[model samples]
Target: MTRKIGTEEAIKRWNRFADAYAANHTELGDIHKEVFLNPAIFSLIDTVKNKRVLDAGCGEGYFSRLLAKAGAAVTAVDYSPRMIDIAKERTPDDLPIEYRHGNCEDLNMLEDKSFDLIISNMVMQDLADYEKAFQEMHRLLTDRGCFIFSILHPCFITPESGWEKSKDGKKLHWNVDQYFYEGTYEQKLGERENMLFFHRTLTSYMNTLMKTGFMLEGIIEPKPSEEMLKKYPSFEEDFRCPDFIVFKLKKR
Candidate 1:
């Protein structure tokens, strides 16, 4: 069994992998982000025009740039200083984005009830203490504000889940195991880098969200659109099982 590491160690690994990770991200983010996450996230969000938006785990700042381009006053935060630097380098001077280095688990520098919308795309599962992150997101939102986030589907993307291949190396049905296990595990991200991820059951996620004062508004298991299919034919296999899940939650 792999030993569990905390959020700081995870961020340190991210810092080391930042350059290679950022290399994969374009203005629309990587292929997975473009094909799966962006559409679902945008569909769940309200108009960003003139809104005070927080890209809670902004990554390389692609989504933050999108929000800013759509007229949002965006404040983007990332746990890794390298990621913050990369995000700043990528962002244009005219874009309404302020990149900050901060962990999602506790964002004390940000004032309470200051944001109109908070989006953490594909970020929740990466942090060690997502419950505290959820609470911090709740604290950062206005009374009527909403929070949107995406993660590997807790039901399907467990620590011991992947495709079961055939004898001839053909992909078969997906496999899932260790669904109830909750802690840090290493997953390969690059040739030399293993990223830490936290696993939680779907029930745990929902319960924690509720406990953190969020009202579940909507959920989406995104599939590739026709346009996306035309761009990447291999994504057709993704229809068989969901690899990601997006949630839209409102402050109660």
Candidate 2:
């Protein structure tokens, strides 16, 4: 049986893996972010000039810097202290971003109705108690405020899902299993770190967001654009299966 771990353990693992994880991220974030998530996220976002934005679970703060450059008043938060440190280090002094060490599930340091937009990119599946995190996001946003987030697609990236490659290392179809299992599972980030992830069904995610008073506005299962494909032709296989899902929600 897979052991169930809590949020604290998850954050600890992130702290330990912070350096390796941040190493891969550039100003545009990692390759995955550059190719898939960033396009989908920025497309969903409205004009951010002079708007207040909160980057929940803002890893090493790359997105925060991007938002600030786009003229948003950005407050970025991460549960891992090491991540926050790296984010602060990477951020330029000219960029006006407030980096805080806090969990998305419980951000009492931030006041209510404090932001115009809240973005949690590639973060929802990392921590347990996503319902609480959703509630906290709703609480932090003003009425009609937008919340955008992305995650590994629940329909495809399950705990036991990967490519079903044939012999001789030929390309093959993707494999997904344990879609109903809702708990903690570990996956390796680098050679040494076995990162923890929380899995939930698609229905659970949508219903919980609705219950948290968010009206779903848009969703994108990002595919590499022609430009991206030209840069990374390997992403052409992304047409076969979606690796990530992005959502845009409005506070109601």
Error of 2 at 68 (Å): 0.0
Q: Write the per-residue lDDT of candidate 2 for residues 59-106, one digit (tens) a residue.
A: 999999999999999999999999999999999999989999999999
Among all windows of 10 consecutive residues in model 1, the one with the lowest summed lDDT is 1-10
Q: Could you give candidate 1's per-residue lDDT for residues 126-174 as a string of tens digits? A: 8888889999999999996999999999889888989999999999899
Clashing pairs in model 2, backbone N/Cα/C closer than 3 A: none
- Worst 10-residue lDDT window for candidate 2 reads 1-10
Cα RMSD for candidates in order: 0.9, 0.8
Q: What is the lDDT of residue 44 in candidate 2?
A: 98
Write down the TM-score of every candidate. Answer: 0.98, 0.98
Q: In lDDT terms, which candidate is top?
A: 2
